[model samples]
Target: MISVEEAKRLILENTHVLDPVEVNLEESLGLVLAEDITSPLDLPAFTNSAMDGYALRSYDTEGAHEGFPAFLRIMGIIKAGDTANYELKNGEAIKVMTGAPVPPGADAVVMVEHTEVQEETLVVKKEIKPGENIRYKGEEIRRGDVALLKGTVITPASIGFLTELNVKRVRVYRKPKISLVVTGEELLAPDEEPKPGKIRDTNSVTLKFALSREPTEVISVDRVRDRKSAIEEKVERALRESDVVVVTGGVSTGDYDYVREVLESLGVRSIFWKVLQKPGGPLFFGRKDLTTVFGLPGNPASTLVCFYEYVLPSIRIMLGKNNKFPVEVDALVSEEIRKKADNKTHFLRGYIQGDGKHLHVKLAGPQGSHMLRSFALSNCLIVVPPDVTYLAPGSPVKVHLLPEVFL
Candidate 1:
């Protein structure tokens, strides 16, 4: 068996990044930018009004107050998206709406609330400073500036920013196409009624939803029996079609376990057989050319844990993400916990409490590999290294908090 770090290193070393593709700006969210994006033109493009009021020379409004108001003739109304052809003279003002281009010679804007309309003229009651309430051209982003760097993951805010810059398309790493092969004869679909020895195939459902958060496209989901021939056929088909193949079950040492054998028969080079981790000790990873394969344990909890720790990181790396692992935090143990002294690391399901500054963690019920109930309530994994066997109350341990949004 290999250590968790070694397993991760091997998986990443074999994983290859997908080729970049040009996609529409609207569909580029959650993808990594392959090319550095430079602004073609300045943001706002031109000096515009930041307020829906009068645009005039700042010197004209000096000493103007409610008691002694400065009166100026309103040249015309300039709404947003309209050009301001008339320039502001010494004692002239233009009723400009927000986002309207600032007229030439206008140094500031006076909000409508501070002025009162008196017969066809505007009375500005407050003193205005130079360049106040004005959005200057190129102030936010200058032309030729690097708006977004390469390898940056696009988010909703990024989409808005690019849209404002009139960016129609972006070059980004293509999302990996994945195929899920769930093997088990006793496994029943979620909607089926329970049988004497049958159980719901929760691993497939859980994995499907979990993979949805990452930059992956789940091309197909196939459930095959424990027979080696059945597993071999599905695995071969998935390897040919998808960039990544996730196989749940038949990895551990069981009578029906045949995933490892089937993978070897189908020419998938085994990178590692097992990892030194508690829940997913029997995890397996392999590769065939550009296609990657993960043989997760049969147990539901073990499968999910292995996916989060290993498979998720591989997908992230393929997408050119900067950080591929779960967020680790130093947390205080709320109670005593014990583990049998062994060389393998233990990742116990845990619940986090308190504010992030002073974090506390408690074990979620049983930490068995098949305990899905406990996994449901867990928001983090309490990491206990191989060297430690016992943890007293208040002990500082590293907690791998589940990310709110996966890349």
Candidate 2:
């Protein structure tokens, strides 16, 4: 078996970023941009008013105060989206609303709260500074400026900004297509009643939910019994149609385990068979041409752990994401943890709590390969290296936050 770092390195070395595709701006959220986005036009394209006020020359309101206000003749009203044809003259003011274009020859604006109008006469109660309450053209972004760089992830604010710039489409890396194959003979559907010696199938449901969190397309999800022929047929078809294929179960050496043998028979070259880690030691990774495959353990917790550590990174790399690993943080352990020092890494489900100054973590519950209760209640996976046989309370440990918790 190889180390966890080695396994991850192999997976990334084999993966390649997908080609760029032009998609509509409405459909580009959560996608990484493949090209730099340049502003097509200036933001706010024109000099406009920043508040509901009267636009006039600064000299017209000089020495004005509440005790002795300066009076000027009202020209006309300029609302937002309306073109101003009349220019302001000396001792003249125009009633301008927020976002309205400032009339020509106007050097300042006085807010309406500071003045009162009487018939056609305008009252200015405060001294107005030049260029006050005016949003200058291109103040935020100028034409031909690089608004967003390549490899930037699109967010809601990005969409609004692009809309203002009239960008109809964006070039982004294409999302990868994936397929899932679940194998087990003593498994029943989730809604079906469990009979004697049979349990409900939770891997398919959990894997589907986990895959939904990534920007990937799951084309198909197939369930097969512990039969070599059935497994071979599904694997071959999935390899031909998908960029990545994840098969949960039949990976370990058992009387009925057939995933490894079937994968080899279909000409899949195995990069690695196992990793030095608990909960998912019997993981399998291989490739055939451009398609990658992962054979995860049958246990529910093991399947999820393998997916989070290995499969998720591969998908992110293909999607052109710079950070392909889960978010990691260092926290102090709340209790002592002991293990057998078997030269294997252990991922324990734990809960993290922050006390303003420091972050403290504790085990959620039992750390069993088959149990999902603890995994569901936990927000992070406490990573313990092979050399660590025991950890005392208050010891620092690396923690990988779950996708739902961090994303």
Candidate 3:
């Protein structure tokens, strides 16, 4: 078995960052930027009112408070999206609606609720400072400044900013094409009635859901029987057409483990066979051309673990992402953890419980790699090194978060 560091080196060998592709702004959300985006025009475009109030020159509000109100002449009212038509002279104010451009010579605003208005006169109770309640031009984004940099994952707020800059499209790294293959002589299609000794295929469904979370286009999924020739053909096809090939089962040293031989024959040189990890100890990885090959264990939990710890990052690197590791959180162990001490790695299914600040983790039911039901109930993966003999309750442990938009 190889150490985790070695495994990472093997994965990154022969890999290069993906190039950028032009895409419409609508399709660029959640995608990584490949180039810097500088704003061509000032954000807010021009000075505008931030609230419904009166626009006044900075000096007019001196000593204008509850006791000393600065009375001034009322100019015209300006609503949102309207250009400037009224101007503010000394000791004069104009009613300005939110988002309306501040008229020339105006440097401050006092909310209407703070002032009493007569037919053509204005009464201000509280003092207002210059630039108060005003959104100055270029306040949000300055022209020729980098609004967003390369390697940034675009979010909704980013899209809104880009739209404000009149950016209709952007350059984003293209999604990697991934090929999935499941091999077993006893496996049958999910919808097919299984004959004696045959089981419905589950690996494909697992890979589909896992890969769907990434920016990838699943080239195709092939379910082949445990035949060496067929496996070779499929692996070769993956090497030729896909950026990454993920195969479930046939990584262990069992008699039916033909994937290793097939991959080697198809020029997918093995980086290492077994990894020093639980649930996914049987994982293997390889590389050929620009395509990465992951030999995932057949067990559901193990497959998912290998995918997240390794394959997921491989995809991100191939997509030109600068950072790929998922966010890790610290949580107190809610129960005693039993394990043998060593240098190996261990991953246990767990669920996190906490109120925002401190997250506590309790192991989810079982830790068996082959059990599928336990995974459905798991919300996190409690990581334990082989050297940890006993993790007492309340001990701090790192937990890899799960996709729990529902949790």
Best by TM-score: 1
lDDT for 148 (candidate 1): 99
TM-score of every candidate: 0.94, 0.93, 0.93
Give per-candidate clash totals: 0, 0, 1
Between 1 and 3, whose TM-score is larger?
A: 1
* Model 3: worst 10 consecutive residues (lDDT sum): 398-407
- Deviation in angstroms for 369 in model 3? 1.4
TM-score of candidate 3 to 2 decimals: 0.93
By lDDT, who's the top model here? Answer: 2
What CA RMSD would you report for each candidate? 2.1, 2.0, 2.1
What does candidate 3's lDDT look like per residue over 1-407, in tens digits? 88766777777765667778999998877789999998999987999999999999868778888888888998788888888976668988889999999999999888889999878999999878878899999998889999999888888898988988999999999888899999888889999999999888888998898877766899989999889998888888888999889999998998989999989888887778899988888888888877778999988789988888888888888777766655578889989998876677888888888877788998888888878777888888888876777899999999888655234
Which residue pairs clash in candidate 3? Answer: 342-386
How does candidate 1 score on lDDT? 0.90
Clashes of 2: 0
**lDDT score of residue 218 within candidate 3:** 97
